[model samples]
Target: ERLHSYETKRANLQAIERLKDHLISVQLTDPSSKHRIRRAVSEIGKRLSSIRNLLRDRKLELDCAVNAAENFQDDLKKLQKFCEQTEKAIQLVESATIFVPSGTDLDYVRLHEPEADEVANRLEKQWKDVFSLGEAVIDEQFGIVSFDTILEILAV
Candidate 1:
């Protein structure tokens, strides 16, 4: 879940922050080395902040998708009820007024929407299992993937 990712990122960022603070506390022998360490800490903090933002975005996206699916089901149900009512009115009213001897022209096709909750849940579960697949192709950590690695996998 995205919550787990947020927690993991929080923990890692906290650990990094602790290391940065310790680095700042210890008197570095070289001024240049101290400056470099501070810069590294700043960069790591920025990256962690970005990850936090991305996690929030993903959570919002998933929530929206689920809500849309729920709304879709509700609308589908309303449509079914409306059609049923129309068909019933056609059967009762048309037989008396229009003087149809046999059946009416309306076709009440029975349609059932599959469990929207189950479909959404299944997609979320599958994505949870498959989330790591994209990470293999895009090593966002280093912004690089070796061609040799790709070639070896392709050979497989």
Candidate 2:
């Protein structure tokens, strides 16, 4: 059961990474939006941190539930709320158009984006609706190859 939950969470993170790529790659159409785009990437980092915290907290709470001899109702409710919050946050940042900042490193994006094509395609197949027009970021070292991301998009 936990494996399934982790799988869902992984997908959500993948989608978010793809969105980050799109924001970096496309925002270059306007040179003035670079700062705003940079800030948006920073905001994406915050969202990613929140998602991970929610997952970790849920797992800890589940452990408490398992150890309890009785009255696990509250733990279960908290877990449910965590799940809802995770999905809500994912939906909030799933689209680049909604959050991409105006100022972006267009020159950097043009040079590195082609390398992301394959990974982006795989991510698209995995979560079509969530990843708009973006490439899958395949970084072997947990590094952001094209965009500014808090976490690396490990090629899955």
Best by lDDT: 1
lDDT of each: 0.58, 0.51
Which runs in model 2 stand beyond 4 Å of their true positions? Answer: 1-28, 70-156
* TM-score per candidate, chains pooled: 0.50, 0.30
Candidate 2 residue-wise lDDT, 23-137, digit = tens: 6688455755655766776786687679778989999987874665133334334433444444444444454566663333343344434544444444334333323335544
Error of 1 at 106 (Å): 12
| Pairs of residues at least 3 apart in sequence or in different chains that clash in candidate 2 | 33-102, 33-103, 34-102, 34-103, 34-104, 36-101, 37-101, 119-136, 120-135, 120-136
For candidate 1, the TM-score is: 0.50
Model 1 spans with C-alpha error above 4 angstroms: 89-156
